[model samples]
Target chain A: MERTPITVSALNAYLKAKFDADRQLGDILLKAEVSNFKRNSSGHLYFSLKDENSQVSAVMFAGPAASLKFRPKDGDRVLVEGSVAIYVPYGQYQVYVRKMTDVGTGDLWLEYERLKQKLEAEGLFRPERKRPLPGFPKAVGVVTSPTGAAVRDVINIIGRRWPLARIIVYPTSVQGTEAKDSIVRAIAKANADARVDVLIVGRGGGSIEDLWPFNEEAVAYAIRDSKLPVVSAVGHETDFTIADFVADLRAPTPSGAAELVVPDRRALLDQLDVLARKLDYVLAKTLSAARDRLSSVASSYVFRTPERLLEKASVRLAHLDERLDLVRPDRLLADRKANLGHAETRLSSRFMAILAAAGYAYGRCAGRLELVNPLSIMTRGYAVIRKDGRIVRSVDELVQDDHLDVRLSDGSADCRVLAVRKGE
Target chain B: MAQEQELKFEEALKRLETLVRELEQGDLPLETAVAKYNEGLALAKRCHDLLKQAEEVVVKIADGETLQDFPKQRE
Candidate 1:
C-alpha cells in the first residue's frame, strides 16, 4: 500500500460522502445530557450531546428547535433524534437534531400511560360513574398550591364570572417527594369538609418532575372517591395525567375549569329578572280581576237580599245532595281534567290557526282557566256523589256501609253510608 | 298557546301605552290609578332586562369574540 497521501480537504470530502452514503450513520438516536448549549442571532441551536464515555456536537436549526416540547438548556438530559453528518469544512462529525425531548418526562409519560390503563381497567374512569356538577355552585373548593398562578387564576375568574360562588383554597404542595401525599390529603379534606359544591384539583404548567404528583395512583383514587364532582386541571393543554382520567371533567387549564364550573351571571341575571317580572304581572292580573268580579257581585240585588240568595242556594243543594248518592268525587274530578285536556287541545289548535294568520290575543287565558276551575261548578252549593267513572244516579250503585265521595262546590267529603232508601 | 302566553312583549307594550295615557290624563280612579302605576313600573323594569327582546340567545363573553349558541338537544 505504498502511495502518495491524500490532501486534508480531499480526505474530509471523501469522509463526508461516506457519512452521507452509510445508512447507520445517516440515522442515529443519542440519549445524552446537553452541554455547551448556545444560540447565535440566526436561530440555529449549537450544543454538545454527551454521555459518560463520549461526546458529540449537535445543531438544531430554528425550525426544528422551535418545535421542541422542552427547552434544551445546559445539563438537560435529552434524547436527540436526527442524522449524523460530517462537517466537511471543520473536518469534524456532528448530529443534526430533528427533535429533542426531556428524558425525565419521557419516562414519566410511560409511567403515566401504564397507570392510566390500570386505573381504566378497574372502571375508575367510567363516564357513567362521573357525577354531574351542580349548576349553581355556592362554593368551589380548589386543591392546589395556594401560591401558584393556577389558584389565583381560578379565584379571579370565578369571582368575576360568578361572584355568588365562594372559592375555598385547599392549599397543598403540588410537587416533590411529599406532593403525592399532600394532594391526597387536600382532596380528602375538601370532601370531609363537605361545604364546597365542587372540587378543582390541579397546578400550573411545569416540567414532568413538577407535575408528577398529579400522575400518582393515589391522586387518581382520591379523585375517583370524591363526593363532590372533581374537575382536573393539570399542566398545559397537551399534558395528561391519571387524575384527569378519573375526574368527572378534564379542563384544558385551571381557568377553563373555572369557566365550566359556574356559569357567567351576566347571562343569567336577565333570565331571572324576566321571570320575576312575569310573576309580578301574573299576580297583579289575578288581583285586578278578582276586584272586578267582587264589585260586580256586590252590585247584584241577590247579594243585598241575603234570604233570596240563600233560598236559591239551598234548593240547588237539595237537588245536588240527592244526586250525591250515585257518584264519587274523585271520578268526577278525573272526568273534569279529561274534558279540560280535550278543550285545551281544541282551543290550542284554534290558537295555532289564529297564530298562523298572525292573529294573537290575550285575556282569553282567564276564561280558559275558568273552564278548569272546580270552584265554578260548586258555586250553587251543589253536592254530587260519583261512583267509579260515572255520576251515581241510583241507590243501586251503593252498598250498605259503603264510603262515598260527596262532592261540593267548595270541596269533597268522604261520607259513609248511614242508610240507603230504595225508590224513596 | 303556551308559547303565545310567554310572548309578553306585545302585551307589556300595549299595557305600557294604556298606562302612560291613563297616568297622563290623571282621571283614573284612585285604586285603579295606583294599580296601573305599579303595573307600569314593573313593565319598565322588564324593559331594562330586555335592552330589546331578542328571539335568539347570544353569549356575551366579557372580552371574547362573538360566539353563537347551539340549539338545545333533548334526551
Candidate 2:
C-alpha cells in the first residue's frame, strides 16, 4: 500500500506536538560548546550548540536572553536547559534555551565569585582600607613578567612622568598555573625591600584564563598584607581581578600604574615655581605696605612742625590781650601796671634763687675738679715741676740739673733740677 | 642640640604663614611688627634652605636601583 505524503509544515507540527507531550523531553538539559553565535537588535540570541559528535541549532528568545545574567559568546562551554521545539516555517527542530551556565570554567569561577561576594560583604573591598598613593615616592617596585611589555610600559611612563623615581623590576610569571605563586613571591619581595616606597603588580591583557593569577586568593592576600602601598594593573580596561580589589590603587593599564606610583615631574616643578613666585609677591607687598605706613607717619603735622600746637595756643592768647585792652582802657592799664610790679618782684626773687643755686652747683663742680686738678695740689706748698711737657716726678725721668717748668696755682715758673734724691 | 636645631620645613612654613597673616592684620605695634618681620625672615630662610637641600629617590623593583633627584622623578 502507498502512503500519502504530508506537507513539511504539518510534519514539523506533528513532531513538535509529540515532543511537547513528553514531560521529560519538554524540559531537558543539554551540555555543549557554543558556536556561530549571533545577536540581533531585538536582543534575541541565536547560536549553534555543538559537541564532538553533532551540532544542534539553539535559540534564546529576547525575553529569556534579557534575563540572562551573563552574556553568551562564541566558544563558550555552557549547560543549557530548554525544551526542543519544531519550527513549522523552517521545517526543523531547535532547542529553545531557558537557562545557560558556564561549564568549561568548571564551577571554579563561580566559586570564586561567591567567595568574592562573601569577602566584599565583610568589607574587604572597603574604600577606607584602600591606601593612598605616595605623592613623592623614593623607590618603586614592579612585580610582573620581566620580559613582557607591562614592565617596559611602566618603566617608560614612570621615567617620563618623574625621572627622579628609582624603579626596580621584579621578574615574575604573570600568567598560567604558576603565575599566582610567582606574583605572590614578587610582591612579598618588594614589601621586604625597605627602599621600596610602593609596589606595582600587573600583566598585559588577555582572555580570562590568561589573567587567572590575579584572581587567585594568594595574590590578593599578598597585596593586602604588604606594608608598602600596592597598585594593581592587570589585563584590559574591562578586565578586573581580585588583586585589583585588594590593592591600594587600581589602574587600567601598566602605564597607568606607573602614573599612580609617581607624580608628574613638570607639575611638581611648576608647583614649586608657583610657590616661589607667591613668596616673592607676598614679600614685596609686605615691604610696600610698611613703606607706605612710614611715609604716612613722616607726613603727619606733629613730625612736620613739632611746635605748631603750642604756636596756635600762643596766638590765641595774644588776640585775647588785645581785645581786653580795647574794651576797658584805664581799668586794663591799671591792672597791667599792678601785674607788671608783682611780676617784677616775683622775677627778681626767682632770678636771685636761680643765681644762688647755679653758684652752689658751680662751686661743687669746681671743687670736685680742683681735687683732681694738679694745679690745686700745687697750692699746698707742693710745686709740680714739668719737663718736656711731662711732670718731673723723679730725677730718673730727666737729666741731672735739667731746666723744668714748675706749675703752681698762682703762676707757672721755669726752673732747673739742681739735685736728685735716691730712696733713703 | 635638638633644641638649637632649626625647625622642619613644614613647621617653619606654617609658622611663617601665621606670622605673615598676623602682620597683614596690622594688629601688632611698630616694634612688635619689626620683631615679627625679622622672625619671619629667619623662618623664610629656613624654608628656603630646606627646599634647597630637598632630595627624593625612586626605586625600581626589577633591578632594585634608586634614582635620586627633585620631587616627582621620571625614568
Candidate 3:
C-alpha cells in the first residue's frame, strides 16, 4: 500500500489521539526509578522514569505536583499513576503524571527517616530533652482532626482516666494538602493558649500518605518548639513519624496518648485510700504512744505520791524539834537556879564562920583589955579626968582658975582650969 | 492556710505522704504530733474529695475558626 504523506504535526496529533483512546494507556501505573528530577520555577516537575533496561519521559504539572508529600530527588524509586500521551508540539510521547508515590521504601518514609536523623543529630530527640508529663494535668490540649475518631477516642479515654483535666481540642486537618499547615497552626495555637499543661498531637491510623503531615518538617519543628509538652500519636503502633521523634513523648495510638497524659482517677483514689489508712495508723500509733508515755510519767513515784517525797523531811523535822526541846530556856533557867542556890549556901556558911571568928577575936581582945584596963579601974571607983577632952595626966596642962571641959569614963564635963600642977 | 486551700491534688497528696512519714518517724512532741495528724487528715480528705467529686469530661471543638463545646453524641 502506498503511504500518504502527512505533516509532522498531523502525525503527532494522530499518535496523541491513539494514546488517549487506549483505555490502558489512559491510566497507567508504573514502578520506576526517578532520574533527572527537576522542579521548574512554575512549580511543575520534569523527570524521567527508568527501569534497568528502559526509560520514559515524565512530567507532573503544578497542580498535582503541589500535593506531593516529599521533594522527589534523582535516583528515587517511585510508583507513578498517569496517562501516556504524545505531545504533538514536541513530537514525543511522555507520561503526564497525575499522581506519584514511592514504591518499596516510600518517599514519605525516607523523608521521615531523613528528618528523624537530622533532628536527632540536633538533639531534638534526645532523651534528656523529653519532658515528663505532668502527673496531674489541669488541662490537656489535643491537636487533631475535629471530625475524626481520634479526638473522640482521646476525649473518651481522658474522661475515663482523669476527668479532672479539661480537654482543649485544637482542630486540625489530619490529611490532604492543608494538613501540614493545619497541624502546625494547631500546635502553635495550643502552645500560645498557655492553658493546657500538655499537648497531644495525633490522628487515627492511616496509610503513609494520610499520615504524611505528621512527618512534615514544619510539624516536627512545631512539636520540638512547643512550650507545652507534646505527645505524638500519629497512626498505628508501627507507624513512626518525624513528629513522634521530635515530640516530648510518643504514644502508639490516640487512645494511648490520652491514657499517657492523665492518670486514672480510680487508681489514684485507691492509692489515696492506702495513704489515708497509713495516715490513720500513724496518727493512732503516735497518739497511743504519747498517751502511754504520759501515763507512765504520771504513775511514777515522784508524781503518784508526791507527799512521800516530803515524808522523810517531816520525820527529820520532828526529830529536830525533839532535840530543840532539850535546849529550852525554862529548863536551862531551872538548872542555873539550883546551881546558884548551892553557891549561895556555901557562901553564907563561909560568911558565918568568918563572923564567928571575928566575934571570938573581939572577945579575946576585950578580956585582955580587962586584964590591963583603966576603964576597969574606973569601974572600981577610979575615974579618968580630962581637961579639954583629954585625961589630966600632967599638971602643966591645967591652969588654976581657968575654965576647962572634962571627960570621964561615964560623962564629959566642961570646966575651967584654976591652977597648973605637976603630977607624979 | 490559703495556700493549703489552693493546693493541687498532687501537692496535697505529697504533703500527706510527708506528714505520714514524719508521724512514723516518731520523735515529735505530743502537741506537734496531734497538730500534724490533724493536718494530714485534712489533706487526705481534700485529696479524696477532689477525686470523688471530679466533674465529667468535657469536649470542645474548634469550628475551623473558634472553639466551641462539642455537641454530645446521642447514645
Candidate 4:
C-alpha cells in the first residue's frame, strides 16, 4: 500500500477493475418492481429497481430498450438480466441492463392469449354476438365499486347526458381477490332487478393485476348471461379484457360507457323541435292546398257565370226554332185549310147537282106514272068507279041491291048501288 | 299513467317523427290531417314536459336483494 495521497479518480478506477474481475458481477439476474421509469428522447431507459427493503438504479441503452417487447412503465414488476458495473465518473455500482422481461407475467400472458383464442373460437367475441344499444335507456345499471372514481365519472356523465334514467349502482369490488365473484353478482342483480335497460361494468385505470377480474372466465360468463345489454369499460384505453370481448358494447373508459348508455337529451329535444316545425309546415301546406282547391272550384266558369248552365239549352231552343222555321208548320196548316175549303165547295156542288138530277128524274117518273094511273087523273078532274063488285054493262046482269065503291085521288067513298050499268 | 309510462322515449320520438312526415306528405284528407296534427301536438307536449321537468336522477346502490339510496356525490 502506497502511503501517498491518491486522487478520487484513481480510487474509483480501482473499484471498477475489481468489479469487472468478478465473474458473478459480469452477468446477473434480478427481480424488482420498476419505479421512476423514464425514456428520454434519445431512447435510453432510466429507472430504479425497488423492493421491499432496498432500491437500485438501473439503465438500459437505446439498443436494448428499442428491442424491448413492451414499454416499461412505472410500478411494473420486471426480470432484468444485466451486468453490474461501477461507473467511475459517479463512483457508484449500477446495472447496465442488456435483457429484461416482465416478472411473473409470462404465465399470465400465456393464459390470456390461450383464453382469448379459445373464446374467440367459441364466437363469444364475434360481431354478431354484440347486441345493439338502446336508443334511450330508461335505467342504467353500473356494476363497479361504488366509491371508485369510475362510478363517479359514470354518474356525472350520465347525469349530464340524460338524467331521465334511474341509475342503479350495483356496488361491486372491481379489483382484488373477490372482484370476480362480486362483479358477477352485481351483473346478476342488475339483470334480476329488471329495471335497467343497459349495464356498464368497469372500473378506472389500474395495474394488470388490478384489472385481472375483468379478464376472468366468471366475469365473461356473467356478461354473456345478462339479459340486459352490458357495456364493458375496463381500465384505460389500452387495456383489453375478456369482459370487453363478451360485452354487447366496449367503451374505452367508464366515462365513455356513460356516454354510450343514453341519448343526449338536448339532441333529442332538437330533433323533436325539428319534427314539430316540420309538422306545422306540412299541415300548413296541406291547408293551403285545400284552400287552392276550393278557390279553383269557386273561380270555375260554372260557378262564376251561373247563367251559362242554361246557355246550351237556349242555343238548343234557337236551333229548334230555326228547324221549325224551315219546316213552316203554319204554312202547311194554311195550305191544308185552303185544300179543305176547295174540297168542301166541290163536294157541295156535286151533292147539289145529284139531288137536282134525282128530283127531275123523279118528277118525270111521276108524270109518266100519272098518265098510266087512273086514280091519278082524279086530280085532273078524272074519276075511278066500281059498282058493288061489277060494272053494270048490261041491264040484264044488274041487280037493284048491288053495293058500289067509288075511288078518288084524295079519298075513297062507299055507295049503295041502286042500279048497275056495264062499262058506262 | 302506467300505460303512458310504458311508452319508451325512443318509441315516442319515432311516432312523433312519423306524424311529422305524414303531415308533411300533404296526401291525407283534411280530417285525418287535422287529427294527426293534434296527435303530434300532444306528443310534442309530452316530450317537452319530460324535458322541462328535470326530475332528479334516482341513484341507488344495490346491496344483495335490497336497494338503498346512494348519496349524491360530486366530483
Candidate 5:
C-alpha cells in the first residue's frame, strides 16, 4: 500500500521519542574509549565513545561535568553510565553521559597520569628545581583539614621531634567538590602571611577519589609558587600525588614531613657537646704550641751568653787603640826636631859662602879707592893747597896775602900767601 | 640571656663549629687562644641550654575567621 513520504526532521523526531521511551536505553552502561573529546565554552563536554569495531557519539552536560573528579580526554578508556538519545536537528543518535569512570584503573587515575605527564614535561617535577627543607624552621605551616588526623599527627610529630618550632594550621577541606579550591586557598594564605619558614601540605590516607584534591593542578601550582619550602605528605606511603612531585620535598606520611623539616634536639645537643670537647682540646694544643715556640726562642745562644757579644766588642776596640798609637804626637814631634837640626846646619854653610863673596868684593873696592886718593898722589910728588879749608888748584885762586893750608900725604901744613905770580 | 633566645639554633651551632676549628688550627697566641676557649665554652652552654629548655609546640588554626589556639586532643 502507498503511504505519505516523511521529511528527515520528522523521522529524527520519531526515533528520538522512541529511544527515550525504551527502558533499556534509558539507563545503559557502555565500556568504550573516548575519542575527539572537546569541552565547549558552555562547559558541556562532547566526545565519541568507541570500541575496536564500532563507535557512538556522547555528550556530558555542564552540570554533571562540573562534578567530575577528573577531566575526560581523548584516548581515555572509560565506562560511561547514561541514556541513549537521538538529536532531532542533526538526525544522529548519541549517548547522554551522566557519569564516566576509568574502566580498568579508574578515570581519576588516568587523569592523574595525564596531569603528571603534562606537568613533568613542563619541568614542574625537575629534581634540580626542588629546594631543601629548612634545617631549623622557626614556624611550620600545615595545609590540611584541621579536624582530620593528618594535622594532629603532624603537630605531635613535630612537637616530639623539635618542640621549638611553632605550628600554624591552614584549615582546609580534604575531599569533595570544594577540596581543590580550599587546598589552593590555604597554600596561598600561608604564603601571603610569610611567617612560616616551611610548609607541609597533605591529608591522611584515603581512597584515590577522596585524595583527588591533592592531585589537582591548582594545588600543584600553589605548592610550586610558594616562597616557603613545601613538604608534600599526602595519603599512605604508596600513594603519590601531583603535589608530591612538584613540592620541594616529598614525605611518605605526615609524620615523615614533620621529621624532615626540623632537626632533632637531642642529636643537636650531642653534637654541641662533641664540639665543646673539641674546643677544649684544640685550645690546649694551641697554647702548648705557643709555649713551645717561646721556649725555643728563649734558649737561643744570644740570650744564653750575652757576654760573648761584649767580649768581641772589646777586642775590636783594642785593635783600634793600637792603630791610634802609630800616629802618636811624641813620635811626630821627634821627627820634626831632627828635620830642623839638618836645616840649621845647611843655613850655617850658606852664611859662610856669602861672607867669603862679600870679603872679595870689599878688597877690589879698596884697591880702586887707593888709586884716586890724594895720599897716593903725594907719593907721586903732588900736593893740594887749601885756602879757607878749600883746595886751590888754579893760580887765580891765590890772593896777595891769604892764608893757605898745604895738604900732604901724611899731614897738612899751614902757609901764608905773600905775592901772586902768573905762570904759563 | 633573653637575647640568646633569639639566636637561631643553626647560627649558634655554626659559630660553635667555627670556634672549634679555629682552636684546632693552633696558630693563635696563648692569651688569645684562652680568650677564644672561654667564649667557645659560653656558646656551647648557651646552645645546650636553649635546646634543653625549648617550649612545646604552639598550634593555631588558620580559618581566616578568627585566629585561635587549636585545642589538643591529647598530650
Candidate 6:
C-alpha cells in the first residue's frame, strides 16, 4: 500500500472549477427553515438554512433582495431556488439564493394572519372609528426609530406639503422585542399631550421580522386606543401590518402618511378659488332673475288701472251732491219771509175799509130816527069834544046815541057813537 | 336672520345658494325678488373676499416619528 499528498491550492481550484461547471448545481431548489439571518451594510443577506437532519449557509445579495415581494426572517420556512457554489475565501460550499418563496406561508405568517383576522372581527378595522385628517394640522406627533429613512421621508413630505405644522419626534425602538412596548408608550405620551393633533406611526421598509413589532397585538391595540388620530406608515407601499388596521388611516409609505396628516396649502387655495367663482356665478344668476321678475310685476294691470278705480268713487260722490241740493236752508227761509209779509198787508187794509163803511150806515140810521120824534107829532095834533062822556062821529052810530057833545078846535061838542070799523 | 347674516364666508355661500333657488322657482313678488338679488350680490362679494384672503400652510414629519415645520419650496 502507498499514500500520496495533494496540494491545497490544486484541490481548492479543482473544487471551484467543478462548482462552476455544473449548471444543475448552480440552479436547484432547496427547502429549509431560516436562522441567524443578518443584513450587511453593503446590502447583502447572510443566514443559515436548516432542515430536520442537515444545515447549510446561504447568502442573498441586495439586488435579489430588492426584487423580492415578501420579507424573509429567522425560522421562516423558505423554498429557495439558487445554485450551489463554494466561497473561495472560506473554502466551503454555500447557496447563493436568487429567488425564494415561503414554505406553506411559514408559521409566523399564519400567526400574523390569524391575529389580523381576530382583530378585524372585533371591529378594530371599522371605518367608523376612523377620524378625518385635519385640513391644517397645527402640530404632529411621530412614533418611529430615531434614525431611519422613514423619518427623513416623512419630514421631507410634510415640509413640502405644509411648512407651518409643528413636528414633535418621539423616539422609540422600531424593530426588536421591545419595539412594541416603546411604540405604544410613545403613542400614549403623544395622546396625553394636548398639543398633538395627529400622529404618524411607521418605519422604513425591512424584512418581515424586522417589521414584526408593528404587527404585534399590543402595538395595534395602542394605535386603536389613541386619542390623537394616527396614520400608519410602516414599511413600503405593498407591506401591510396590524397597525394599519387599527390606525385611523393607512398610508402606503411614511411619506404618504405625512401627506395624509397635513393639508396641501396650494391645493386648498385653488379649491377655495374655484368655490368662490361658483358662488359668484350663482349670485349673479339669482340677481338677474329677481330683477326680471320685478320688472314683470311692475308692468302688471293693477298698477295701470289706478285711475279707473278712482272714477267709480267720483261718480258716487256726484250722486250724493244732487240729493243734498233740494233741502238747502237758505231757499226755505226766503219763501217763509215772503208769505208772512203778504198776509200782514192784506189784513190791515181789509179791516180799515170795513170800519169806514160801518160808520156811514150808522149816521143814516140816526137821521131816520130823528124824523120820528114825539114833538113833531104833537105840533100837528087835532081836538074834538063829546057831551056827557060820549062821542058820535057817524050816522051808523046814532042808533044807539043817547048823549052827544061836539068840540072844534076852539069849541066844544059832546056826542056818543058806538061803531066798529074794519081796515085792511 | 341666519340667512341675512353674511358676515362669514360659509353663511354667505349658503345665502347665495338659497337666493338662486328662489329666483329659479319664479314665485317671489317683484320687489322681494329685487331685494334678494341685491343681497345675493353682496354675499357673492363677501365669499370672494374670503377666498382671496386665505393663505396656505405646509409641515414636515421625520422618520414618521418626528415633526417639523416644512421648509417653503423655493419657487
**Candidate 5 lDDT, A1-424, residue by residue in tens:** 9999999988998898999999999999999999999999999999999989999999999999988755566777888899999988898889999999866557567788899999999999999989987778878899998888899899888888788778899999999989999989988988887668899999998767778899999888988888989999999897888999999999999989988988888888789989998987887678777778889988987678888768888899898888787577987677678778778877777878788888898899899899898789898888888888877889898878789988788887888888888886
lDDT of 2 by residue, B8-75 (tens): 54467677777777776765666677777778777766655544442433433344443333223244
Residue-by-residue lDDT tens digits, candidate 1, A265-299: 66655654654465455445556766887999998
Q: Model 1: residues >4 Å from true position, as ranges?
A: A1-18, A22-24, A34-75, A86-94, A97-102, A105-107, A270-424, B1-75
Question: lDDT tens digits, residues B1-75, model 6?
Answer: 211221364456666778767765666666676677677667666665554442342334333444554344443
Candidate that would win on DockQ: 4
Between candidates 2 and 3, the one scoring higher on lDDT is 3
Which residue runs of candidate 3 sit more than 4 Å off their true CA positions?
A1-105, A302-306, A319-424, B1-7
Using alpha carbons, what is the TM-score of model 3? 0.61
Quote model 2's TM-score: 0.54
lDDT of 1 at A370: 80
Error of 1 at A296 (Å): 26
Candidate 4 chain B superposition, TM-score: 0.74
Could you give the candidate ranking by TM-score, starting with the highest?
Answer: 4, 3, 5, 2, 6, 1
Deviation from native of the Cα of residue A330 in model 5, angstroms: 13
**What is the full ranking by lDDT, best candidate first?**
5, 4, 3, 2, 1, 6
**5 or 6, greater by TM-score:** 5
Q: What is the TM-score of each candidate against the true structure?
A: 0.47, 0.54, 0.61, 0.66, 0.56, 0.52
Assess each prediction's global lDDT (C-alpha) against the native.
0.77, 0.77, 0.84, 0.85, 0.86, 0.75
Angstrom error at residue B50, model 4: 2.8
Across residues A206-315, which tens digit of lDDT does each residue of candidate 2 receive?
A: 76778888888888788888999888999888677788888888999998898888777566545445544554555566677778989999899978997886798889
Worst 10 residues of 6 chain B by lDDT: B1-10
Off by over 4 Å in 4: A1-33, A38-71, A79-100, A317-424, B1-8
**Candidate 2 wrong stretches, greater than 4 Å:** A1-74, A79-100, A117-123, A126-128, A304-424, B1-75
Residue A113's lDDT in candidate 2: 91
Output the number of the lDDT-best candidate: 5
Give the Å error, residue A266, model 3. Answer: 1.5
Residue A83 in candidate 6, Cα distance off native in Å: 14
When candidate 4 is compared with the true two-chain complex, its DockQ is 0.53
**Whole-model lDDT for model 5 versus the true structure?**
0.86
CA error at residue A238 for candidate 3, angstroms:
1.8
